[model samples]
Target: MASVTFRHTSVTYPDGSLGLADIGLEVREGEFMALIGPSGSGKTTLLRTLAGFITPSQGEVLIGDEVVAAPGRSVPVERRGLGMVFQQHAVWPHMSVEQNIAYPLKLAGAGRAERRARVAEVLELVGLGGFGSRRPSQLSGGQRQRVALARAIVRKPRVLLLDEALSALDEPLRADLRAQLQAMSKQLGLTVVHVTHDRSEALAIADRIAVLDGGRLQQIGAPDELIERPASPFVARFLGDATLLRGRLENGLFHAEQVPLAVPAARITPGAPDSTQASMDVTSASGPASRGPASSSSAADGPVNRNAPLTGLLAVRPEQFRLTAVEGSPADDAAGETPAGTSPVNGGAGNTPSGGNAADHLTNAPSSRDASTATGPGARVTSGDDDPPPALIPASAPARVLSSLYGRHSCSARIEWSGLEFSCETALWRPQPGQAVRVDVTAGTFYPLSAAGSTPAARQEGEHAA
Candidate 1:
């Protein structure tokens, strides 16, 4: 097995169009690295460059310590010690599986007996034992694909490249094949680079994923890291169903038109001059709740300035939002009476009220009262005492359900609040359209609009400021 590296690699076509732009990445030996992006995002171009089908216009391509591609010089594809599978299972209809698997060995001048032994070995390895004599026309699509895989690995090449190898199969078949491919790679300790457009597939199969867009490399990391801490708005939107809200960060809170949420201090990275502290108090609906000391000296992590208000974007995933039905709302009382066993405050016997605390329904949420409170745009709620109430701290916002999609396990609702639409997961509560709901954001990641190293497209997409 061998590691692969691309250093400052670029590909410029004859029409002056750029296919890859200054790409740099490394695939460790025996690592399953997945390359993923939308169409025209340079994923295939990078793979082709590595396979010697396309030479880099600049920079170098190295396999292990040997520089195989550099500028005008290149290595022949046949001598690269790489095996590749494409979207189409290009098996010959007239050739038997054994003949197909043995073709490479024949080209290498292996004797007949040796070729037969190697073909039998790989056939059993790919779970196609004793099916070698079956013609491609007689085999199922999945079997044909297995034959293709067997042919590719028969040579025992150092690197295996898979370009949408399972895309042609059905979902169940694709899943089965994916599991098989993953096991095969590990069992053989093969260095693999898989190019795929399926986000879930890449997340499930690869050790690390590299994202690309507009001929440039986007963020690359483990699946959880990309989902939890995306480097840019595009990554957040692409990798999952995340809603980007235009807002400003002030006093350690993210404030939109009507949605006010306490930003987790850990998500705040230090970059701006205004950043000088790392901790901030998270205010609940009732009153101020102490998070920790606000002094930068006490923070174990570096400082993050929350004193100055900065325009930015907040990315919220569906699961991170807790939705609670509003009490006495038109949708809830549309029948002109409360449901048989439910009430306004404490849900009655064997009943769950729409107005009940959201935490009672979802396991991952805090109490709806403790999470946030619905307030109008720029409206502040006080303790309702004679003395002046503390400044309105970040909490929750009121929303109206626009549509609902019922899944087998949960229901996802499209909600509108302050002229912004968000997709939220409603656990066990089937909210109807036009129902008034309260949206409580349990967690969110903030990215300043002016953050450095962000792509122009990302900045433009995240500029949904109200």
Candidate 2:
């Protein structure tokens, strides 16, 4: 296995279109890093540059300590010890599975006996041990993909590159192949760079993920960090489903729908704990956030904004909103909304003690507008030992449920409030469409995203222009 490195690497098409712009990153030895982005985001270009299929316009591309590509310098694709699996299966249609897998060994002039041994070994590695005699045409789509994978790894190349290799299969088959591929990587100790547009797929398989937009690197991080503490509004929305609400920032707090919420100082201004710090110790000694390649234009590398009264955005994931039915209202939810003096937000009587029912405590909680509004999501409220932990703040307005979709483990409920529509995930109960429900906002479940204009569309435009 070999580590990959790009030192200020960039790529430009002959027509003057920028492919990659000053990308500096390192993939540690035996690490699995995934490149994810939208169309024309330069994910494939970066992969191709590493494969020696494209030459860098500036800087150097290195595998191990050898310079493979740079301005006016190049290495042939065949000379690079890399295995590539493309979106399309490139297996020989007329050849048997064993023959297809053995072709690489044959090209290297291996003897018949050794070729047979290697073929058998890889077939088993890909879970196709007994299908060596079958042709590509006769095998299922999944089995054919396995054949492609087996062939790619048959030679034990130093690095494996997969470009949307599983995009063509059904969901179940894709999931199964992902499992197999992950297993193969672990058992073989393969260093892999996979490119895909599917966010969940990358999150599921990659040790670290590099997010791209247009042709620029947005962020590189583990799945949870990016989800919980996104650096920018674009990153927050791109990673998954997010509700972004426009708000005005003042006194280190954001006010939206007349509800005051605290956010990270870095959200509006640069140089604060922005999205770049979203990566954490993601199963590797070399953290992806600190070591992975990042774009030169990232917020972490930009200027600081110490000034206040900025217009920013609020981001919250569906699962973060604690859904509750107002007490003594039309909906017969167990916990009733207590009077202002008795509400949890004002440190009233509704606060549940340690051993009390969890839902009951949440049910009696006050709306966000009624709380102290001193902290953001994941922040803690100081309390005396005798006092019950502060209850979550309720939504500024009670939401009217517009739709509901149920899944096996959870239900998605769409509600409208503050003249905005939001989709929230609820585990305990599924409210009916047109039903009115209350949303509880807490410092433990929300984040302040960046300014509204730093959206995916704007970033894409900037990337293309660069």
Candidate 3:
């Protein structure tokens, strides 16, 4: 019903401690905006500022077009037209659910019949239709929280605020309540701002998420955007399980000293020119020598250089790395020969050639390390199986599995490549520990460490100050 805005807002305590630092963001009308961060990150400070509990030392907080919080003037919390639910379900023990929900309408002088009708409607909305007569003392934790929710929405407020509303409930109940809350917000067209430390919850429900650290806004974007193209290393590490590799970008290819890996610059930097062809050509021509040292100039056969070299970090998630069990030592594959019974796996994203026993191809030959064992947990080892072999990447770096965790549909492995550890996921092939495998970076994002406003010192200062 109403959008929320924080325009250059800041909060400072009496002792000169900063609560928020020049924060600016907007929550669209009828949008579910989630504010997330660690403890003392200023998310709660921002929420309290919007609720009129804390006034901004400078700038202003606006609800729709009205300035509700500003220096020397502020609206009263009771008149802000906001419905709020906190971690604790603050329901009266002696009151029935219907009475608790109707109390807000009673305060506004609504007639008994009108209050009863509104209470009944919200009780049904929160999935407590037939339990309104029960007292809070008799209800389960989840039911009591639902009662708290029904009470908050009974008066049909324009904006709703949830500060860890479901954190006290169990996982299953929390998940169910999250779905119900999303539906309720849409059906009622409420502008909602939810604050939680749970990243998964925010990613699951928010139209957009605002990440804060050290009393400063880190980055705000849709869930996928933050996960795929994080603006900084802190954001990438905070949002998902990403392995950060220090590297340098030369001629549109990322070169790192920790491993023999070269990722196309285009994959790491959005909108960068596609240099996959040039990189592949260079790798084919130079073989393992390409990973040795940086060349002062681009390859004679490579494309013309358009962007300058950059020194920064590369963020690669587990799912972005493709793995293939090496039939023999990497030295054997360097001769460009496919083994006796195995075919060269295609080198494209999500491409798997048909008609091969994956276990046979992976287990038939002796590895140089002699560590290749039988199929791992949940592996299908039958011959003539429909499941195809994993892709054999030509320019992949060599790595050995240190450990593995098997899930229902996928297996995650901890691999050590060139003295660096990385986490990778495999869905089709189950690689055992000490097994030699080729690790290829299927996709990654590069962040220039020298970029403005993304300095590590600034992030560290914020974290420490918070």
The whole-model lDDT of each prediction reads: 0.67, 0.64, 0.66
Q: Write the per-residue lDDT of candidate 1 for residues 1-466, one digit (tens) a residue.
A: 8999999999999999989988899999999999998788899999999999999999999998989899989999998999999999999888899999999999999999999999999999888999988999988899899999999999998899999998999979889999999999999999999999999999999999998776777778888777776765556666866665655554334456435444432223322222212112111233222222112121112223333345555666676565667776644322221111111111111121112111221121211222113333222221212111124444466688999898765578888876656777654456789988776554555545432213343233333233
- List, residue by residue over 1-466, the lDDT tens digit for candidate 2: 8999999988988999999988888888888899997677799999999998889989999998999999998988877888989998888998999999998889989999999999999988898888999889999888998899988888898899999999988989899999889988988899999999888899999988888765667777777666665665557656756555444444323355323333322122221144432221111112111222332333323222334333334555575455567554444342222211111233222332222211222233332333433433222222222222234322255778888898765578887765556767765357778776766533221222223225443233222210
Which segments of candidate 1 are over 4 A away from where they belong? Answer: 258-307, 328-397, 450-466
Question: Which number leads on TM-score?
Answer: 1
Candidates ranked by lDDT:
1, 3, 2
**Cα RMSDs of all predictions?**
11.8, 10.4, 12.3
> What is candidate 1's TM-score against the reference?
0.75
* Model 2 alpha-carbon miss at residue 443, Å: 4.5
Where does the lowest 10-residue lDDT sum fall in candidate 1? 341-350
Pairs that collide in candidate 3 are none
In the range 1-466, model 3's lDDT, one tens digit per residue, is 7999999999999999999988999999999999987688799999999988999999999999989999999999989999999999999988888999998999999999999888889988999988878989999999999999888888888799999998999989899999999998999998999999899999999999998776777778899877765655556656766666655555335566457876543234331121011100011111211111111121112222223344445667676676777776332222221112111111111122111211211222322211112344433221111112223212665689898788776678898887667788776556788889887664565543221213333222222210
Against the true structure, what is each candidate's TM-score? 0.75, 0.74, 0.73
Instruction: Kindly report which residue stretches of model 2 are placed more than 4 angstroms away from their true locations once superposed.
Output: 249-253, 257-311, 326-395, 443-466
